[model samples]
Target: MTIAEVSEKFGISQDTLRYYERIGLIPRVNRNKSGIRDYTEEDCKWVEFIICMRNAGLPIEVLIEYVELFQQGDATIEARKELLIEQRKLLIARMEDMQKTLERLNYKIAVYEQVVVEKEKELKRSEN
Candidate 1:
C-alpha cells in the first residue's frame, strides 16, 4: 500500500509515518519504481506494533532500542523480554497511581453529591 493508504488505514498522519522511518522507530519502507513508499505487509505490522507500544506509554527511546535489538537477530531475545518486562512493571505502577487518583476524585464527587442532597432536604423542611 502507498503511504497515503497506510496513513488512512492506521489513522496516523503521513508526516508521522515518514518521521517514524527517519527516527528508526520503524524499518525503512520499500519504495516503488516511482520512488514513493509502498508499505508491505511486514511494514504494516511494524506500524501496528509501534502504535500499540506508543499508546501504552512506552518511551520513544525504549522503543527505538527495542527495534534495534530486534534487528540484531535471535541473540537479543532474552534482552527484549527483559526490556518488555521492565516496561510492564512501570506501566503497572502508573496504573496503580491513576487508580488512586480516580478513587480520590470519586470520593470528592460523592461528598459534594451528599451535601447537595442534604441542602435540598433542608430547603424542603424550611418551606414546610
Candidate 2:
C-alpha cells in the first residue's frame, strides 16, 4: 500500500511514518518505480508493532534499539526478550502509580458527592 493508504489505515500521519523511517525506528519501506513508498505486509507489521509499543509508553530510543536488534538476525533473541521484560516491568510500575492516582481522585469525588447530598438534605429541612 501507498504511504497515504498506510497512514489512513493505521491512523498515523504520513510525516510520522517518514520520520520513523528516517530515525530508524522502523526498517526502510520499499518504494515503487515512481519513487513513492509502497509498504509491504512485513512493513505494515512493523508499523503495527511500533505503534503498539509506543502506545504502551516505550521510549523511542528503546524501540530504536529493539528494531536494530531485530535487524541483527537470530543472535539477539535473548537480548530482545530481556529488553521486552524490562519494559514490561516499567510499564507495570507506571500502571500501579496511575491506579493509585485514580483511586485518590475517586475518593475525593465521593467526598464531594456526600457533601452535596448533605447540603441538599439541610436545604430540604429548612424549607420544611
Candidate 3:
C-alpha cells in the first residue's frame, strides 16, 4: 500500500501520516526507487495501533516511550505493561470526570425544562 491508501484506510490525512513518520510515532515507511512511500501490511498495522492508542487519549510522549520500549523486544515487556496500566488508570479517571460533567449537564437541562414550564404557566395566567 502507498501513503494515500493508508491515509484513506485510516481516515487520517496524508500530512498526519508524514508527521507521524517525522515524529517517530510510527516506524519509518519504506520507499521505492522513486522515493515515494511504499507501506507494507506491518507498517499499516503499526499505524492502526498508533491511532487506537491516540484515540484512547494516550499522550504522545508516553506513546514514544512505549514505542522505544517496544523496539527493545521481550526485554521491555514488563515496562510496556506498566505503561499501559498507568495509562488505563488515567483514562478511567478521565471517564469519571466526564461522567460527572454529563450528570451536571443533565441536571441543568432539567432546570431549563422546569423554567420553560413555569414561563408557560405565567403566559396562561396572563391570557386569563
Candidate 4:
C-alpha cells in the first residue's frame, strides 16, 4: 500500500510516517519504480507495532534500540526481550503514579462536592 493509505489506515500523519522511516523506528519501506513508498505486510506490521509501543509510552530511544535488535536477527532475541521487559516495568510505574493522581483528584472533588452541599443547606437554614 501507499504511504497515504497507511497513514489513513493507521490514523497517523504522513510526515510522522516519514519521520519514523527516517529515524529507523520502522524498517525502511520499499519504494515502487516511481520512488513512492509501497508498504508490504511486514512493513505495515512494523508500523503498527511501533505505534502501539509509542502509545503505551515507550520511549523513542527504547523503540529504536528494540528495532535495531530485531534487525540483528535471532542472536538479539534475549536482549530484545529484556528491553521490552524494562520498558513494561517503566510503563507500569507510570500507570501507578497516574492512578494515584486520579484518586487524589477524585477525593478532592468529592470533598468539594460535600462542602457545596453543606453550604447550600446552611443557606437554606438561614433563609428559614
Q: Note the residue pairs that clash in candidate 4.
A: none
lDDT of 3 by residue, 1-128 (tens): 88999999999999999998888889889999999999999999999999999998899889888888998899999999999999999999999999999999999999999999999999999999
Deviation from native of the Cα of residue 7 in model 4, angstroms: 0.9
The models' CA-based lDDT, in order, is: 0.97, 0.97, 0.94, 0.96
Query: Model 3: number of clashes?
Result: 0
Q: Lowest-scoring 10 consecutive residues by lDDT in candidate 1?
A: 60-69
Q: List the residue pairs that clash in candidate 2.
A: none
Could you tally the backbone clashes for each prediction? 0, 0, 0, 0
Best of the two (1, 4) by lDDT = 1
Candidate order by decreasing TM-score: 2, 4, 1, 3
TM-score of 4: 0.93
> Following a full C-alpha superposition, what root-mean-square deviation does model 1 have from the true structure?
1.3
Q: Tell me how candidate 2 scores on lDDT.
A: 0.97
Q: Per-residue lDDT for 21-94 in model 4, tens only?
A: 99999989989999999999999999999999999989899999999999999999999999988988999999
Candidate 4 residue runs with Cα over 4 Å from true position: none
Q: What is the per-residue lDDT of model 2 for residues 1-128, given as tens digits with 9 covering 90 to 100?
A: 99999999999999999999999999999899999999999999999999999998999999999999999999999999999999999999999999999999999999999999999999999999
Per-residue C-alpha lDDT of model 1 across residues 1-128, encoded as one tens digit per residue: 99999999999999999999999999989999999999999999999999999998999999999999999999999999999999999999999999999999999999999999999999999999
How far does residue 50 in candidate 4 sit from its true spot (Å)? Answer: 1.1
